[model samples]
Target chain A: MQKTWNNKAWFLVLPVLLLVAFSAVIPLMTVVNYSVQDTFGNNEFFWNGTDWFTEILHSDRFWDALVRNLSFSVIILAIEIPLGIVIALNMPKKGVGVSVCLVLMALPLLIPWNVVGTIWQVFGRVDIGLLGHTLEALGINYNYTQDPFAAWITVIVMDVWHWTSLVVLLCYAGLVSIPDAYYQAAKIDGASRWSVFRYIQLPKMKRVLLIAVLLRFMDSFMIYTEPFVVTGGGPGNSTTFLSIDLVKMAVGQFDLGPAAAMSIIYFLIILLLSWVFYTVMTQSDAEA
Target chain B: MARIDLDHIRHAYGAKPTRESDYALKEVHHSWNDGGAYALLGPSGCGKTTLLNIISGLLHPSEGRILFNGKDVTNLSTQERNIAQVFQFPVIYDTMTVYDNLAFPLRNRHVPEAEVNRRVNEILDMTGLSDMARRRARGLTADQKQKISLGRGLVRNDVNAILFDEPLTVIDPHMKWVLRSQLKRLHRQFGFTMVYVTHDQTEALTFADKVVVMYDGQIVQIGTPAELFERPSHTFVGYFIGSPGMNFMEARVDGTSATVGSQSIALAYAPAVGGAQKIELGIRPEFVRLQREGLPVRIGKVEDIGRQRIVRAEFEGKPLAVVVPEGMDIPADPRVQFDTSAINIYADSWRVGSEG
Candidate 1:
């Protein structure tokens, strides 16, 4: 058999390549360009190699924000993953209640992120908000504006309330795709409820859970909108995540070189963590 | 093992079942014998799986009771009933090893560890999965996974019955034969009250001692393979049981004589069909003998199927099939004689008895 080698087929990918260069590559290259340079007023630039990266790495503000970001991601994943599985397991498998429950679950995910932030901000005000008023009437000291602990709690709660639905919806999709035969077999096997979840439901939901964990980790790590809108990194930088701090540096003080360096480090950390998560999960999946 | 008595069992999927059409399984009142192998044979949507589920207690019938060993177990769950079922597709714990998969049912019931090991090893040997016992079930082929499903059903020693719903549908052709024979051997050795459900006639006829034929949500006949072949109780049974099926023709009958088309043939005995609007005479292709002088048929195409020849012919503008021995010659003036003793008379699709 004779094979035809046509290099013309490479032309088919030209449009996508150009679109990706314009959308992602060019912007990323600009950040890379800024990270290794020094800039003065009037758009004058000088070649400065790795000075901003080293300075950003040594700064306590950057390290503190990174630690806070990692902790928040860990907390969100730990709470949301198990909570999502439990809620999905308890959801109705059939009947009119299925649609109703699905719609309710999707409601939290449909609201814009900033709107969610605003809603929580108003709801958690110690002086005028419903939750804060109730807590105060019950004789609790809860004011997010002045208390660092209260600010952290308010931000964490707001993030959880806004994002837990994504995990729930993903786990629900995994749960529903499992055929009824598995449940029937489990019942006939004399399995207890926990055994059914452990062996059947959990195993069936493994892939979706991996996806949920990865998505929640990345999204919560880079989170700035909802928390900033609600707390504004208040109470002495108690809830200032990496992105919030980066924006404060770049947009607030116009330190483009250091901010670009910090942003690149943040992106690399997320990429590394996500890759580790994906590989570890898929490896266990294969070995199992 | 226990005798399963379905006492006037009926099921309707809809909440308000006002008419007979609403019922998925019409009334089934029959007792399957203890330690007997039975097969429920039917086409798709014929209520076979519904009846199987009812027997396994996965479903609660809309009407009537199910009894195991003369004890009413209508309200019992599948676990309480102590029945095991293998579904059409293999249901395995993907994270477990083959050995662990087989041991799952026993461990779920809190069986002794020693007993679990014994039963799991025994099933592994029986299912030819001993070599793969340490391998994860997720990596195995479909047939091996299905074997795990069957092994799970067979691991328990005290189950009331083991129900199989088309368990061999996922296996390859050669493996299907091997697994079927293995199942038959297992049935012989254990004598469990097995009720295998399938749409294939060969599987039902070969695997079961008594084949229960169903059509349109009703059991038309329940008999041994030979009995079903020799005497089909309904026209549907006659059509569904055999290859090329039984040949049916409109007939007018009086005493021991049946007039099919223009020729009148003598019957073995009188069939009491009193004022029935429709009458049909049915004979299997194997029983339609080609003779020198009989009702004339225009021979169309003769099919030589290795061991036998099926002569396709037309009689009175109706197609007919006659099975002839290999190398038998079709005479110049072709004729067919329906074996009198093998003929069945049907009135309104129901076979009429000689006593009637």
Candidate 2:
């Protein structure tokens, strides 16, 4: 009741507060505002609480895109996490080969995402491209433009090519930080190769694996630019991830309400799943 | 248990090791009796760990061979050599329980579940980790995790020898004593041939029946702790073994007397100093007694260290230390007498003749 008020203190934090409001809070609030309302023409809006949300939840197009997003993320994680670990493990631990390998691993990561999409789009053309023509020359039916499965495969491979290096770099960082003593001790313990990986390498890499899983999951789920540039969500919506569908709904069809609502849902899904992934991965660390 | 022999073992980290200086370990020829405990004591980068790694088969020697009970195991892997090693920092499987960590070595060889259980339980009990057997090994204190590391080695009954490379460095001082005594007890209880490597002299002297003192990548002397204190085979051993270590002075020898500057001290044996480029007198601080009469010395400082008073002095322009028991009188004009029985003469850093 006797507390003195010094209003000048607010001035100290005003810049950061305004910065956050403009960059993050404002955009997020705009999405939330649009999510629960109907907007039409110049500055006209109507209260439509939860209607857009229900519409988005009920749409088949949304569900299919969601399923596609989930499947793509799962498949990529299943392949890339283990594959990245294998590659990192096999990479030279020292000598001149180390820098060479590091530079090569970083190469794919340095290319712009759209450039990656463009590279694969041109490279997968059956008539002119090396890979496509080589496959055709090998008597295989490979046409990414015409077949849905081929398009999905092309997109998956493209994503893997573009982003597996992130996983490799992270895992390599985790691997190299491990002191040499663990390996020496494992060797002295008569541990098999599998046991060493399981008991030493895997446990040591847990933190990085968490970041890897979260990054790969979130990035792959919200993937838009690369596949959009490459397939344009063609072959009858086979590769239309949530981000692509959201873009189509908002920009192509001019359906702002559903897109904004879906955007909120998408953000929530990422936040929720990331929490789950983080908790599941890091729970043992807390116990330890 | 099997006796282990290292035959002229030498190792160099670099491939093009043409000079003696290039070798990380130089010509270590030694043997460990079956069921004996030995410690390799040396300064950091003096190749104690390199020699330990070689014995554990983690490093193959550049020259020479290793034998286990007369069987050549020079090229064998550590697993094949049946060795267990604990590292400087405790190396526990961070995700595994203490029991499972202890059981790892035995399980790796596909030991029967019952036997593995029996052995794991025995080791857990022996290491006093039975209370924490179910806890994660990674979550325990450093010393507890080290106990698990030790248990993993001890769990395997078939190992040729178990080696420790400064395994107690991460442990707290009080726990270091607990673990050292535990190790000593384990050595007595199981009679496992052990080779411990450390820079700590107290640990070496207390843990090993014979301490192998190394200097400059070479084992200079291997002897009982008493022999190392009484007569160091090399000047390095004398300098590295005791609390403040042995005090050595540049000297000249003739008959039974060794002359340091203008002071002549009687020696136990007359070392033949023929053709020797350098001659030195080595004596432990414990043997240098301060009395009212003898060679003149100027007392510099007296340090009271609980049970012993280390009298620092200068004799013939050379600094010396004398360890006098607590409550021992220090004369206002203090001079010193070197224990004639304990005085060792060194020529060119090596012991003169066979008195060592």
Model 2 stretches astray by more than 4 angstroms: A1-9, B354-356
Q: What digit string (tens of lDDT, one per residue) describes model 2 on residues A144-171?
A: 8889998999999998898899999999
Q: Provide the lDDT at B350 for model 1.
A: 91
* Global lDDT of each candidate: 0.92, 0.90
Report the CA-based lDDT of candidate 2 relative to the real structure.
0.90
Q: Which parts of model 1 are misplaced by more than 4 Å?
A: A1-7
Clashing pairs in 2: none
- lDDT at residue B10 of model 1 (Cα atoms): 96
Error of 1 at A102 (Å): 1.5
TM-score of chain A of each: 0.97, 0.95
Q: What are the candidates' individual DockQ scores? A: 0.89, 0.82
* Per-model C-alpha RMSD: 1.3, 2.2
Error of 2 at A77 (Å): 1.6
Native-to-model Cα distance after best TM-score fit, residue B225 in candidate 2, in Å = 1.2
**Candidate 2 chain B, poorest ten consecutive residues by summed lDDT:** B347-356
List the TM values for chain B, per candidate: 0.98, 0.96
User: Given candidate 1, what's the lDDT at residue B178?
Assistant: 89
